[model samples]
Target: MTGPHPPRPGAGTPAGRPPVDGNAAAGLLGEVLAVEVTTAVAECRGCGAHAPLAQAVVEVDAAGALVRCRGCTRTLLTVLHVPGGVRLEVGCLAALTGAAPTGGAPGAGG
Candidate 1:
């Protein structure tokens, strides 16, 4: 018989803890962005390492999410949900690419 399952990778941590993968960040980003952000490419400013956004380390909470580079543990992106709009901080990415609109906007030509 299977024993109790092990704790999830980033779960069961102390308070103020964040998940350890970009999946959480992607979910939070989905609330604001219309594109599939996780599949995008991100170049870390600190180490100049390039990888998919999905590979970044992400810490998520009710207020916002923090994304960091896997290579050097440097902060890459931050997303905050605030009144009226979301605040995004992207100080860690030297380059990012591949984003498409989610579509279905009003007052747009078909």
Candidate 2:
């Protein structure tokens, strides 16, 4: 399942609100969220081996993230849950906001 990484649009939960529960979080399905990439694909700086891409799961504690690399099959850096991973950039955020980054909203093309 390879696709763009989802990003978090808002900061922490409400300023003065209780934390979200598992059921609440589960309800977020198909709600369209985002997360910047903590780490993207890269080759081993040492041996020049292909570093497989990975999906970093977001955590609530703000702790580092977890990535299961494909090539080395190893976990690399831990993310702080920011926006835009290595390959992605904030410029493309427009798409998530119902707009297009290239120009105006995407249009039919040949």
Best by lDDT: 1
* lDDT over C-alpha atoms for residue 109 of model 1: 17
User: Which regions in candidate 2 have their CA more than 4 angstroms from the true location?
Assistant: 1-40, 55-62, 81-110
How would you encode candidate 2's per-residue C-alpha lDDT over 29-97 as one tens digit per residue? 223233222222334432344432333222335444443334344443334545653322221111222
Q: Residue by residue across 43-100, what tens digits does model 1's lDDT show?
A: 9989999998999999999999999999999999999999999998887889876455
Stretches of candidate 1 off by over 4 Å are 1-34, 99-110
Candidate 2 residue pairs in backbone clash: 6-34, 6-35, 7-34, 7-35, 8-34, 36-84, 37-85
Candidate RMSDs in order: 17.5, 17.7
lDDT of 1 at 4: 80
Cα displacement (angstroms), candidate 2, residue 62, comes to: 5.4
Each candidate's TM vs. the true structure? Answer: 0.58, 0.23
lDDT of each: 0.77, 0.35
